[model samples]
Target chain A: MKEIATYVERTFESVPDSQRKSEIMQEIIERLEDSAGKLEQDGKAREDAINKAIVDFGNLDEILQELRGQETGKGKALSSLWFAVIGSLLVIALTVFINLYYSPGVVWFLYPTFAVIWWPLCIFFFGKWRKGR
Target chain B: MVSSDLLRGHLETILLRLIGETDRYGYELFSEIDGRAGGRLVVKEATLYAVLQRLERQGYITSYQGDVSGGSKRRYYHMTPLGKANLEQGIREWHEAQEIINIFLRGNIQ
Candidate 1:
C-alpha cells in the first residue's frame, strides 16, 4: 500500500497541474486502499495484500478511465450551460438593438429569435463539447 | 444450460435487479448473484467491474463510498430510477430476441 501510494505520488509529481493531479491521485489511492483492505480482511497478510494490490494495479489505465469519465461529464455540462446563457444574452441584446433602431414591436420577436438562434448555437457547442470530451 | 450470450444477459439483469433491491458493494453484489443463479453463473471480477463502470457512465446506476471499518471503505452501487426503466427495456428486448432465436433453433415452423 505504501509503495502504491509512493508510485501514485511520483507520477503525480510529473504532472504540470498540481490540483488536477492531486484529484486524480486521490481517487487512485482510494481505490488501491479499498482493494488492499479487502485482501487483508480475506486473511492475507498485510504485506501480501499490499503486494497483490500494487501488482494488480500495475498500470493506471482503470483509474485514468474513471477520471476521464468524470472530467468529460463536468466539461460538457459546464460548456453547454455557459454557452446557452451567453447565447440567450446575445439574442436579447440583438432584439433590444433592433427595437431601439426601428420599432418596439420587434420585442414580440424576441422569443422566436432566441429559439432559432439558441438551438443551433446549443447544438454546435454540444457537438464540439462531445468531441472534445 | 444457458448459452454464454444468454448467460451474459442473465448476469446483467441479475446485477441490475439486485442493486435495485439494495445498494451493495462489489463483493456483496457477487454473493447475491451467486445465490440467485444457484451457483450456475458467476461473473469474473474484471468483467463485473467493467459492467458496473459502464452502467454508471450510462447513468443507469450510481455509487458512493460507504463507511470505513477496520481500514476498508466500500463503494456501494445502486440502481437509479433510469436504471429501473433501462432494465425493463433490456428485459423486454432480450425476451424478444430470445424468442426469435429459440424458434429457429427449435425448428418450430408455423
Candidate 2:
C-alpha cells in the first residue's frame, strides 16, 4: 500500500499543483489501497496484491493522457512552446514596424527583440524546467 | 466481453445506469462494474476518471467528497436529473440497436 501510494503520487507529480489535483491523487491512492486490500482478502500475497493493483491502474502515459483530458491546467511544455511561438511572432511584427518606421537601415530590430523576447522566455523556460522536477 | 474501444462509447450510459439506483464512490462503482461483467470487462482507473470528469462536466452527474477510506477521502458520484433523462434516451437507443442487430443475425427467415 505504501509503495502504491508513492507510485501514485509520483504519477501525479507533473499535474500542476492544485487542490483538485491533490484530491484526485489521494483518490487514486485510496483506490489502489482498496484494490490491494481486496486482493489480499482473496488470498494474494501483499506484494503480489500491490503489484496487481498498480498494473491494473495502467501505465503512466495512459494515466497522464486521461488526466490531461480532465485537467484544465494544460501541459507546461506545450504552453511554453506556444508562448515562445506567439512571442516570436509578436516580436517579429514589432521589429518590422519599428524598422520600417524608423529606417534603421539594418535589421537592428533583431537585437532588441532578441533581448526583449529571449531573456524573459529563457528565464521562464528555465524556471519551468527546473520546477518540473 | 466488449472491447475497450467499444466500451469507451457506452461508458457514460453505463455510469448513468450504475448510479441510477444508488450513488457510489469511484472504487466501488468501478469494482461493481467489473464484477457485474463477470470479469470479462474492466475499466482502467485512469480512464474511469476521465469519463467521470466528462460526465460531471456535462452536468450528467455531480461528485462530492465522502468518508475516508484507506487513509484518504473518497469521491462519490450521483447522477443528475439531466442524467436520468439521458439514461432513458440511451436505453431506448440501445433497445433499437439490439432489435436491429437481432434481426440481422436472424437473417431473411421471415
Candidate 3:
C-alpha cells in the first residue's frame, strides 16, 4: 500500500496544478487500496494484488486532455482580460495626453468619446462570454 | 452480454445515474457500478475518475469532501440539475440512435 501510494504521489506530482494533482492522487491511492483489499480477501498475495492493480491502472490520456483543456481555457481568459484592461487604459491615456498637450478644447469630450468607442466593445465581449458560457 | 461500445455507453449511463442518486466517493461509486453491472463491466479506477472530473467540469456534477472518522476523507460527487436534464436528453438520443441501428440491422433500412 505504501508502495502504491508512493507511486501515485510521484505520478500526480508530475502533473501541474498542485491542488488538483494532489486531489487526483489521493483518490487514486484510495481506490487502489480498496481494490487491493478486495483482492487480498479473495486469497491473492499482497504483492500480486498490488502488481496487478498497478499494471491494470488503465490510460491517463483523458486526464491529460482535461488538464490541457483547463489550462488553455484559463490562459485564454486571462489573456483576454489583460488585453481588455490594457486596451481601455491605453485609449483613456492617449485621449488624456492629446487633450493636455495637443488640444485643450477637446478635454470635455475625451471620456465621452472613449465611452462611445469602448462601451460597444466591452458589451460585445461580455455578450460573447455570456453566450459561450 | 454487451459489445465494448455498448458497454461503454452503459458505463456513461451508470455514472450519470449514480450521481443522480446521491453524492458518492470515487471508490464507493466504483463499487456501485461494479455491483450494478453484475460482473459484466468493470470500470477501471483511472477511467472512472477521469470521466467524473469531466462530468463535473461540464456542469453535470459537483464534488465535495466528506469525513469518515476511521477512514480517509472521501471526495463525494453529486449530480447537478443540469446533469439530470442532460442525462434525460442523452437517454432519449441514445434510444433514438439505437432504434435506427436496430432497424438497419433488421433489414428495415428501406
On TM-score, the candidate that comes out on top is 3
TM-score of each: 0.50, 0.64, 0.68
Candidates in order, interface RMSD in Å = 4.6, 2.7, 1.5
Model 1: clashing residue pairs? none
Calculate model 2's interface RMSD in Å: 2.7
Candidate 2 lDDT by residue in tens digits, A1-87? 579878877877887677666777777777778789999999999999999988888655654555566554446656766777687
Candidate 1 per-residue lDDT over residues A19-91, each given as its tens digit: 4346446655766677899999999999899878766655554444554565565678667777777777777
Model 1 per-residue lDDT at B62: 88
Each model's number of backbone clashes?
Answer: 0, 0, 0
| Candidate 3 lDDT by residue in tens digits, B1-110 | 45556667656667898878877888778778778879677667678888888888888988888887458878888888999998898888888988998876876445
Docking class of 3: acceptable
Model 3 misplaced stretches (Cα beyond 4 Å): A73-133, B107-110
Judged by lDDT relative to the true structure, which candidate is superior, 1 or 3? Answer: 3
Query: B1-71 in candidate 1: lDDT tens per residue?
Result: 34557577566666798898889887678667768778776555445665676678778898887898557
User: How do all the candidates rank in terms of TM-score, highest first?
Assistant: 3, 2, 1
Off by over 4 Å in 2: A38-46, A60-63, A70-133, B68-72, B108-110
Model 2: per-residue Cα lDDT over B29-109, one tens digit each: 778988999888868877777677778767899989888665666788999999999999999988898899898796676
DockQ, candidate 2, comes to 0.31
